[model samples]
Structure formats: structure tokens, C-alpha cells
Target: MAKAYRSVIEASMAQNDSTIDSTIDSTVDSTIDSTIDSTVDSTIDSRHDSTIDYAIDTTIDSTIDPIIDSTIDSTVNSTIDSTVDSTIDPTVDSRVDSIIDSTIDSTIESTTERRYS
Candidate 1:
């Protein structure tokens, strides 16, 4: 009877050891699966961030290009206006300047003739 009881107990112990080993294997598999999932999630997140950054950069460039062009145009226009007098007509100025020069020359000629006489 004692020998039979000992054999039964030994058999139960072997069965328990097998169950523990199976549980340990399952736990290891679960850990590996979790690690793989986390890696996938990290890759996806990085890709998403890169896409978002690219989109933002494109948006900023789109917004800045027009602003820069407009600023450049305004600056060029302002510089031109400041450098040259746009209000005065060139034709009128040339006529007045020519008349003044002719009057001065005539006055000088008449004064010289009178002094010599």
C-alpha cells in the first residue's frame, strides 16, 4: 500500500511539473508578443510624427512664400517712390529748365554788349 501511494504521488508531481513548464512557456510567448506589439506601435508613432512634421513644413512654406513675395514687392515699390520724384512731370521740368537757361544767357549777352559800348 505504501509503495502504491508513493508511486501515485510521484506521478502527480511529474504532471504538475509539466503544467508549470507549459505555463512558463505561455508566459514567455506572451512577453515576446507584447514586445513585438510595442515595437510596431513605436514605429507607427514615429512615422506619424514625421508625416505631421512634413505637412507642417509644407504649410509654413506655402504661407511664407506669398508673404515674402508681397513684402519684396512692397519694399521695391517703396524704394522706387522714395528714390525718384514721381509727382513731378519730366516734360514740364525740362521745359522750365531750358527757358531759365536761355533767359540767363540772353541777360549775360546784353550786359556784355552794353558794357563794351
Candidate 2:
């Protein structure tokens, strides 16, 4: 049982690490995209100052939205995969795992509080 639990925990950890890496990569990608987007927005804003057509704003948003949606989908898939790997184990009792998780959480929190106090 201990070995089984450890294996599950290891798989959970691997999934968690992958999730973290995905998040970091997504964040970096978003940051770069955002920076480029802001630059483009600024240029558009400047251009709009001359033309004054609000419809162009809608067009720009429509063009950019798909890219953003795809990024979101990728991030969501990583999250879902990690969640599936961790909490969706068939051999484990989810209720028992939840209890174990809560117990560990509480114990750690209590220990931290005692240390600070």
C-alpha cells in the first residue's frame, strides 16, 4: 500500500511539475504576446486618432481573439491533464484521499502557525 501510495504520489508530482512548467511557459508566452499586443494597440490607437472609425477596433479584436482563445485552450488542457492524472486515480478512494489531504494540510498549517507563534 505504501509503495502504491508512493507511486501515485510520484505520478501526481510528475503531473504537477508538468503543469507548473506549462504554466510558466504559458505565462512567458502571454507576457511576450501582451507586450507585442500593447505595442500594436498603441500603434492602432495612434492610427485611429487620424481616422476615428470605431469599427476598426472591433476588427482588431476579432483578429486577436482566436490566438488568445487557442492559448487559453492549451493552458486549460495542461491543467485538465494534470487534474486527471492526480485526482482521477481509480484504485484510490477519493474520499479517503481528500481526508488525507486535508489532514496533511491542517497538520502543516498548524506546525507553521506554532513555529511563527
Candidate 3:
């Protein structure tokens, strides 16, 4: 049981580390994309400052920024919720159940031994 618990812990840690790395890479990529989009918009605006260009810039900002923000927010929230549900909660519940089962079995065996002896 102890061995099993230790294995679960190690596996959970490895999974969490992998998740963190992936999340970081995803965030960095998203940030870079947003930055590049903004830079391009700025360059276009500088070259041709017109009402239509202004509207396009406004549309891009309104559309792109929120989409990026929403995507990031959803990603972070889902990651957190999944980590708690899939990893932390299950690990804790497993350990607790194991300990309880061990204790109960030990107690029952000892009681039966005393009666038989």
C-alpha cells in the first residue's frame, strides 16, 4: 500500500510538471502572436492613416484581444480545475481510502486473533 501511494505521488508530480511546461509554452506562443498582430497594425496605421484603416484597427483590437484573452482565461481555468479534479482530489482520496482500509483490516484481524487465542 505504501509503495502504491508513493507511486501515485510520483506519477502525479510528473504529470503536473509536464502540464506546467505545456501551459508555459502555450502562453508564450499566444503572447507572441498577439504582439506580432499589434505591431503589424501599428505599422499599417503609420503608413496609411485613414478612417477605414482606423475602423479596421478598431475591429482587430476588439475582436483579436478578447479572443486571445478568452482563450487564455479558459485555458488557465480548465487547467486549474482539471488539476484539482484529476490529480489532487483523486490522490488524496486514494491515500485516505487506503489508510482506512488498512486500519480496519488490522483491527478486524487483531480482534479475531484475540478471540481465537
On TM-score, the leading prediction is: 1
Clashes of each: 0, 0, 0
TM-score of each: 0.47, 0.31, 0.35
Off by over 4 Å in 1: 1-26, 86-117
Task: List model 2 lDDT by residue over 9-90, tens digit each.
Answer: 9999999999999999999999999997889888988888857666766776788777888899999999998887887764
Tens-digit per-residue lDDT, 1-117, candidate 1: 999999999999999999999999999999988997899888999999999999999987899878999999999998887656654556668889999999999999999999999
Q: Say which prediction, candidate 1 or candidate 3, comes out ahead on lDDT.
A: 3
User: How well does candidate 2 score on lDDT at residue 42?
Assistant: 86
What is the lDDT of every predicted structure here? Answer: 0.90, 0.88, 0.94
Question: lDDT of candidate 2?
Answer: 0.88
Clashing pairs in 2: none
Better of 2 and 3 by lDDT: 3
By lDDT: ranked, best first = 3, 1, 2
